[model samples]
Target: MRIAILGATSQIAKDLILSFAAHSQHDLVLYARRPEVVSQWMNNIGLVDRYLVADFTAFSPAEHFDALLNFVGVGNPAQAAEMGASIFDVTLKYDDMALGYLHQHPDCRYIFLSSGAAYGASFDEPVNETTQASIAINNLQPQDWYGVAKLHAECRHRALAPLPIVDLRVFNYFSHTQDMEARFLITDIVRAIRDKTALKTSSDYIVRDYLHPADFYQLVRVLLAAPATNTALDCYSLAPIDKATLLTVMQDKFGLLYEIQHSGVAVNATGRKPNYFSKNKYPKEFGYYPSFSSINGICNEIEKYFMQDNLY
Candidate 1:
């Protein structure tokens, strides 16, 4: 299969590319503003010749692809917060470019890496594909920009694109590529354990579900094979982990020397916490089941850090 990826600089995109590279039969066309940046990663996979250093808006593919994966835009929440409202403009610009291409090449399958934010900061309940998104346009905020733009892109793709495309809404995902300094829960734990520093956190009552690389591999493979239809699926593990439980595991299993103190309030930075982890309906729909449970996935990442020095 011939696959093309936009935003090749993104760490997640690189992970996906590496996963695809495991299958030598699959050819990849990687696009980025700076091709030199992804050169090392491509070389690592022995696919250096498969990259194209070009802007997404200007570059049109010379060869047809069986699938096109759009991983563009500022995905980091901290970065999105800095971008503020312009996030919408930047997101739609690239999305429209891809949509226009789909109009020209309706046969190609398009897969967008969306986020749980696209569900509009729902704290009320666990969101699934069937859940209705809740975005408050009148009371827009910087935090909401990323989710709003993602939701907008999903809507636009479904309504405007001539062909059916897949939008995978990622709730929480962790891998070796995860930025250690980032304020994510897993990274915080990793840092605390490594540094032997007392981990300071907000309330540990919040619930989060994480996606493993193995699960991601299965998901992409299933999506590539399944006939496209305008649909969105949540990317989550079969198991959900609570913040407190994760901390407990770290303390007991890894001998983490950290003092866990809560601020006594559960402040929803993005929105209210989902009552439950997003449902894993992708398996039922596409026959792609996740391999790692929350504990196993976390342990695997930590083990990589300790043994291989591939610290996240």
Candidate 2:
């Protein structure tokens, strides 16, 4: 399969490239805002021949690809806060560029890396494709811009795009390549385990799901091959993970220590309700189930950071 990946420097995009490159039959064309960085990374991986260094707006593929994955966006909350309304404009601009490209090549399957934020500020229950998204009418803040932008892009594509497209509303994802300095739950746990430090949290009553990086690409491959009909699928692993059990396992297996400063708080840090898991048809529709459970996935990541001598 021939594919073109936009925002190729993204962590997820890089993981997807490494995953796809393992299969000799899959050919890839990569584009990033920084082509030199992408070229260096791809060259290190020994698959630099299929890459082109160009910005999203200026990039025009020489030939049609079987699929195009758009992984572009301002993901950092701090950056989103700093960028303000420009976040929405930048996001929609890239979406429009990709959609226009898809318009010219109607046969190309389009996969967008949307966020669980598209569900809006509510997380009272497990979000499915059927869940209605909310908008903050009275309290629109800088942090809300990212989610709002994603919601708008999803709406725009579903209503207007002429080609086959699937917006994978991703929740939590963790891997070895994740920045250690990032204050994510998984990274915090990994770093604590590595340094033998105690991890304290306000509460562990909240529940969520985590996807293995490999499984993410697998879902994309399956959906890329499937008939895309303007659909939004909640991207999650099969296993539902809660904070208490996850910490328990880490403590038991790796002897990591954690303390819950408070309990009885069901609400997450987002101030909205928490979704234990997401409902999707990846298993039934695509026969795709993630091989790694939440614990197994974390252990795999831990092993990569601490135990494994050779980089994968």
Candidate 3:
């Protein structure tokens, strides 16, 4: 299959690209805002000759593709906040680009990288297929914009029911390719271990299910091969890990030092989500099942990072 990947420079997209190159015969054409960076990365990883790198501006409907995966969006909370209201425009732009392509090639499958934030601000419990999105239309906030943008795209996809589009709502994703400087709980833990500095974290208990790249790739592959349908699916692992357990594991295996503070930890731009993952097993019907549990996946990827950096 020939696949066109938008925003191919993203960590998730890069990981998936590597997976496809290493494990499959699919031809990939990577489209990114900064194609040079992706080209350099491909060269560094010895994949320079294996794929084509093109600018997103060069994305044309004239090119035929079996599938199109849209990974274009802000990666971190800081980026999400910085992008602000423009998230809507950026999302709509790329989504419309893909929709236009789908119009030309109706048989092509589109896999959109959505987020659990699309479920809206409150996440007191894990989401399921039955869970409806909760949005405060009268009281919109900056944090709501990102999720709203993704939700809007999903809405548009569903409205175009004849098209083969699948929205994968990822709650939490961590991998060896993740930026170390990024402000995420697992990254903080990794930094603490790497720098031998004590981690100071808030006492706000939260549960997260970090999807492994392998599992994510499997989900995408499953969706690509599944019967055509216009729907959304929540990404999940074998199980989720709570903050307490995560901290304990990091401390034990990685020699991470951490102190819990009652305050001063920065809040997420997308609002507080005490339970950010999903319990939805809908993807199982499409023959997708995670091979790693949250802790196992975290350990596996972190170990790979350590090995790569000679930190172990």
Candidate 4:
């Protein structure tokens, strides 16, 4: 399988690239606005033939290449707000072009990295594919830029109906390569613990489910292999580990517990919050189960860290 990834710098992209590359049957082609911008990010994307420079900012399918996986998207609110004009052009217009390519190619399968915020946040319930979406921008306004942009993108992908699309409402996924300052609570907690003997968060850490990078890639690869899309089977949370468990794992792994603060109320996010996801269906369909969750991967990462220096 030859896979082409858009936004090669993305977390999902990095993981999927490595997964695709590791398989002798897969050949990956990476695309982004600038190769040099994320050359450091694509260290695992060694199998890619070249970094096809194309910007989602200007929805020009002619500018981008047709690949198996179109795993490029931005969910950062500040960034999306800044990219106001580009957001519409890329998410709506050009995104369709990419989908059309997938639809026509017969060989290409589109796997979009989306957010759970697309589920509409006001309703506090575990969401499944049955949940309805609120297409109103007003409903999504308070959800933050990242949520709004992602919902908009997901909506656009859905709108390009009559085409096969895989809109994965990915939850909190942490990777070793992302910027340390990003908003991921686990990464932030890890950073804080690394920064000082005592780890602290200004508020009781929000419970976010986590998915490991390896499992993420497997999920994507399996979905692509089967070419199931525009349906519940393709769209899913990467894999989940609830917040309490995540924090507990972190504390146990590092042996550092700190004065965690709390604002008292739930930290509301915009749109829907189906942050909880199950890999059961995906695993059943593809025979792949993620080897790690938040805690599962932490211990392994720690073990590998110590072993590198023969500390075992």
lDDT of 1 by residue, 97-134 (tens): 67767778888888888888887845566776567777
- Global lDDT of each candidate: 0.74, 0.74, 0.93, 0.55
Sorted by lDDT, highest first, which candidate order results?
3, 1, 2, 4
> What's model 1's lDDT at 91?
78
- Residue 116 accuracy (lDDT) in model 3: 94
- Say which candidate scores most in lDDT: 3
The Cα error of candidate 3 at residue 247, in Å, is 0.2
Which is superior by TM-score, 2 or 4?
Answer: 2
Q: Order of all candidates by TM-score, from best down to worst?
A: 3, 1, 2, 4
- TM-score for candidate 3, residues paired by index: 0.98
Q: Model 2: runs farther than 4 Å from truth?
A: 46-53, 75-82, 262-273, 309-312
Task: Look at candidate 2 and tell me the lDDT of residue 62.
Answer: 53
Give candidate 4 regions above 4 Å deviation.
40-66, 75-89, 103-107, 135-145, 155-162, 202-206, 232-239, 264-283, 286-288, 301-312
* lDDT for residue 20 in candidate 1, whole number 0-100: 74
**Candidate 1 residue spans exceeding 4 A from truth:** 44-47, 50-58, 264-269, 272-276, 280-283, 310-312
Total backbone clashes of candidate 2, pairs 3 or more residues apart or in separate chains: 0
Candidate 3 residue-wise lDDT, 130-176, digit = tens: 89999999999999999999999999999999999999999999999
